[model samples]
Target: MARHPVRAKDFAVGEEPATVVVGLIASPGPAAEMAEALVGGLARQMGERLPGARWSVRVVADRLVGGPAPLHELVARTRRRLLDGGWQLAVFLTDLPLQTARRPVVAHASSAHGVAVLSLPALGAVGVERRADEAIVRLVAVLVGGGDAPVDVKPSGDDGGGKHRDALLRRLRELGTVAGDDRGAGLVTGVITGNLRLLIGMLRANRPWRLAVELSRALVAAVAAGVFALVTNDIWLLADNLGWLRQTLVGAGSVLAVVLTLLLGADLWERAPPQRDPEVVRATREQVVLLNAVTVTTLVIGVLALYCALFVLSLVSVLLLVPPGLHAAALDHPTGFSDQVELAWLVSALATLGGALGAGLESDETVREAAYAYQPDRSLTG
Candidate 1:
């Protein structure tokens, strides 16, 4: 008989050859894109390290673990699902922010379950895509046993002595145990940071050309309103009657109202839920609500700032068209610096209302697309 090749189990000098399934677990946002890039093209890169194993990457958008559940419970549930799905190893790339103690963690892994979770926010500021790739590569090493892995698989410190990596390992070891409990310490921090990411995502979704068109429309409407006020002598009459304080408050209120209306009418605050169950998607919906509020507030503030700038320019243009000296002769009331200030406020307030009209010109689809542009296309997940 021909000599039998060494059996896979008998070849015990090396780690067992296993199928590692990288699960891109996300909340239906930009994090999905980050995960797709990481997992879809990860096999070639990971092949250099775990040459004996097979790798499969899939987007697990359903069954999110970002809840009040304990760490171990979360890990166990996720591990069970992955293993039952025919994966020996599972890794989750999540957009939700994760932390230990009072500090944020970039990634966490549990070798016992062969599961790892990476927090997308940890790769902050810039170079997020590159950092995400590096982080996953290192985390995978931990899942497969770090010894003899590729050079780039190191998490921190020279020779594995890095404090950051060590701390991460400590946390990883405590997964699915009482030792890992932090009693929701990370929730507040996660919400705050997650909202910031949401705002950035929304901004990124709005293309430059779309923003320009919207801004131009608003400016034209505002200019028309301002010029009409000046030409019809409404600004002078209102200025003579209203005090500066009242004028300022009215202008501020107008902008605020228009902003709120746009935010509400456009339904920019709502998020598309990825799962079917109401209870399962509740936490995600809450996150979307908080993030939507933040994004809408940021957009409103930006619009108000721009409106102020244009209002000043319009005032300057008005002065050039009809000087203050000419205004005094035509006015029934004495024209003074205070009056001019009041006129400016009135014009700004009226212009804000005009902006509401301009905002209406934007198609509903454009607003929705711009609002959720950063969100991953669910169809592409398949």
Candidate 2:
């Protein structure tokens, strides 16, 4: 008798094809949100793109990488979780920027362990979700296709001549350059474009605006100093005579002063130890420099926000208390909205300087915590 083709449902439960479970372990906040949102889509894509396997995805919101650790250690930890959870593959997504002594790393995959770690900041500020989706897919493909022959191999029951695998590999190359021998871990380092993009991503992940909110004491001091400046004739005279150039210099100087005071007072700067190995020392120095840069940028942004707020308040005070005629008479010149704006600008600068004094009240831990939510507990030598 003619035989019909065998169907999947016709097979016994035990004889059915094995399902490949993929786990997404994400750091708290943005990384976790992205992982949760992408899990469903990723499962569908994995099933469609890598044929002949029943694919499933699970997202766990946890901090897998709190600080810098050896790449192998990170992979091993992830591997343990994968095995314990009965997952075939695992990926850890972190918002913190990852760098090697050579370059910033976008992703690291250990095919031997069936685990991957991706730095979200390396993907840039825009289209992070899309890029992350593509990155996870490529990583999954790498793990499934085998590390040695990532691009050339065809999936089981796939007769399309490895086109899908080649396409995934091509996309991965576009994201970053794959390095390291196939016998162990593989690294994907960003190019120049990727580096610039990574910097932007890091800045966003820092969430500089939070610094403004945390500086409650400083904001109060600034408002007090601004109110004192607004009612003084001397400040009005200074504002009237100080040209735009002088005003700009004063504002910049005030911002610099506040940033310096915070950095020094809070001990936010990282200092490398003298007794560590030479390689560790060098890596620590590099990381310290990068962390300091990010911290300084965050402070500047926060101080500028404070300055803008002071300026608005000063302007309103000027409008309400100092009449246009009085402002003109005090400066011995005709005054208009421009005069009011200049006056507000000068007062804001002076108030920002006063805010610097208040920064002393904030503890080192508070500023550090505010500025770096994902800051490393200890610098990684690698």
Candidate 3:
């Protein structure tokens, strides 16, 4: 018989052994909750993805380094507790409170020596090491390296008891937008408003984890778009004064929404813990569509108002060019005061129209949906 005898599985099959152990290290004090949450999240995540592995949380009370992880302390602890159970690896997650949004998670994997170590920042677990929504998704993907088949992030059309609604309810509570019962109707309104904000964010955001990033990003983008519309409307406004670099940046910002949306779909929203209400899903989509429409309308109106203003300003400028002595009869007056006044009034009217149109476009559709989607389940989220 061909020696099928000493197989790798056979060598370890009968051996009594504790399962692979994972070690978690974090700080103490007020950050204890954050540390515990990280450990809990990691354990849960690993349980779902790596069921074969066993894990434990170790809180290192080394306050010498403040809230950030102490690398040496973590490495020392790993050898003490985790290595006993035939542990395969140890991941030390920490928060870098001094850094910006760039490169949050740091992993140090080492498997050849019968042990692997990954030291990564929890990202936004603390206030300072906060990253964007997309960044969080990307980090997760990196940590949970993809080998298995790609799972679709989009919600299946199957009416699974409004899982989406349940998800939203969870988010609302997290955002403190609603409270009380898990299935309370008082939060229905919050769900609508929260969901609308989510749609705008998802459609215009590059990160899924940003389901909770708030309106700061949107406001910033809106301001950039408004500026771009003005500068692009008049080539000289940007090209002549701001130069090519500034013009390019402005143009890029105006067109980056699609890219943001794509990133959010892949790296952000789908992977994030259940957020946004399911019932509000439709409303969120509608709100996003309306925002696009309103954005266009406002841009057009703004351009028209600007044109009128420029025209009137041109007349005033022409008047400045003419000498007082050159002005004779109203017909021959060099300053063109009569024409300038007429143009200014036209400009004012157009400005008023644009402002009114912009105001009118601000329907509750977007706001309601934004609230609904994000803050859907106030109980779970809270």
Q: For each candidate, what TM-score against the reference? A: 0.48, 0.50, 0.24
Clashing pairs for model 2 are none
Candidate 3, residues 11-66, lDDT tens digits: the string is: 24664212333444344543445455455455444333322223343444323344
Model 1 residue 55 CA deviation (Å) reads 15
True-structure lDDT of candidate 1? 0.53
Model 2 ranges off by over 4 Å? 1-194, 275-282, 374-382
Which numbered prediction scores highest in TM-score against the true structure? 2
Reference-based lDDT, each prediction: 0.53, 0.66, 0.32
User: Is candidate 1 or 2 superior in TM-score?
Assistant: 2
Residue range with the least summed lDDT across 10 consecutive positions in model 3: 372-381
* Greater-TM-score candidate between 1 and 3: 1
lDDT per residue for candidate 1 within 1-382, as digits (tens), equals 1212223542246544444455546556787766666666677666554344455667666446645333434444555555444344566666666533323456665543455666666567799888777666666655544222332323233555344333322322221111112125454344445334333433433332343234556657877877787776656776667777787787777777656655776655544346555433443333344445555655665566756765786667666776787677666656776656666667778877787677667655444333322212111122
lDDT of 2 by residue, 1-382 (tens): 1212224543356654346678899988989999988987997776555544467898988786668754544655676566555455789897766644335567776543457778888777789899889888877776555332334335425656445544443332222221122121121122223333333344555667777677777777877888899999999999988899999999999999889988898776654345345433433333333345556777888788888888888888888999888888899988899999999999999999888877877766556545653322111112
